[model samples]
Target: MIGIDLGKIFKGNLKEAVNVVNRVKEEHRSYLYSGIGRASILLFKDDFEKSVAFIEKIPPSYRDFCYQGIFYETVMHFHKYSPINNGWDSEWDIAKVIELLEKVDEKYKSSSCFGIGRGIMSFEFYYAESRRYLFSDLVWKSGKALEGIEASLNGYCFQGIGVEYGRKLLNYFFAQDYFQPEQGYSLDNRFFSEPLNKEINRTLKGDKTLKGDDRENYYEGIKMAVLENFKDEKVRNYILNRIRERERSSGN
Candidate 1:
């Protein structure tokens, strides 16, 4: 839908985009066929006041998803919107996102953070698998996103990341049972952290090992860059120790 919306907006079809949203709305109140269109206008063209005004006009039940779409698109398309050319400047992108998210109502914040985390880890896996970035670079890039986020909301982000990785590695049913949130299942650090540990273990198997300062920096980067704002000592230590254990077991 992003592609369709992008084309419509690029061609100055703002009314067309609105008509599509309205058309979908008429079919079902809960059916939002395309959010990326609204998100693009929010992030690229509209100011915060306009963004807020636009969202205010939405049904209260649907506003949270609006915030989620805006933040998700911001993170999902970081490379395209990033200030740097041919390189990631995640800090710049993160700051831009947080500036808007911070002002959002507290009730809607967690969903947006979840989108941010999901967005970062999706690209992390993409860049790592495609060899578009070194593992170290990927760590730093994701760290920038994690670092700028609120400490309390980081788990929501991690849950999103875990859901992404779980979807790739596990069957559809298991992914929901384990990672996807539901009435009985709340977002927990373990739900997300464990999957991340598994992903790192698999990724490291075929990747070059970081040695000396590079190695230390890699772990430290995970510690400081990723966990500086995250206050869960148990989860924080668990991730660091797990990586060290994997490094030792593999004879890195």
Candidate 2:
């Protein structure tokens, strides 16, 4: 319900718009997520340092939200391969993003939790906990796989994708639902703001006919595939899952 001064921002007066957010935040510091989001808008519009400054003004606990990422372009750059952004410049100071996330992780570990001051932090952490996964060194791969999913879902033919890939896609959606149910329900809906429930429904049920031990085996196979391919270096489960799956299949 924060009334952002879009008029000031539309006039190219970012400072004024930011000041309005600051004043609003002062009165309602408990709900300062909107204010922090405003700063990110500026950051998206090429207002760099000041955006960071506004973010810095937010309580240290909430500063982690700042690191949650600002621009959709930045999010897509890491989370999707061929993302279509409205005004994303390739040369933007992506380092600043790393710097912010690093600072939040290294410096603000003990600060108050975002939304905790107002009793809403757990809701955010419960879903879309992207803050926990961010890093400066970039521990993830470009999501070219999203294209494969979209194509398979929208494509007329099954394209001979196996049970392993099918389970991987479904597992991914389940995890997303656990984090952000809305996004988990439909990638195109959450990310692209498109009405795409038909494709999403089709994808979710793409493997519905498989059952029993066959289904279990397929799920296990996809789990192994994801760990071996997309897992971060720090995840101990990657090595363990591979070894365990190998032993389980070999009857060792």
> What tens-digit string does per-residue lDDT give for candidate 1 at 1-252?
553344236344444544555555353322252264245444455366665555554556666656656666666644332424445444435666777778878998987776676567567656555645443344345545566787777666655554444333333223533664442222255666455555455433322433433333334333433353234566556656765775676454
Error of 2 at 36 (Å): 2.6
How many clashes (backbone N, Cα, C below 3 Å) per candidate? Answer: 0, 1
Question: Which runs of model 1 end up more than 4 angstroms from their true locations?
Answer: 2-46, 76-93, 132-144, 168-252
Candidate 1 matches the true fold with a TM-score of: 0.48
Native-referenced Cα lDDT, model 2:
0.33
Give the runs in model 2 whose Cα sits over 4 Å from its true position.
1-35, 69-73, 76-105, 108-252
Candidate 2: which pairs clash? Answer: 128-179
lDDT of 2 at 46: 53
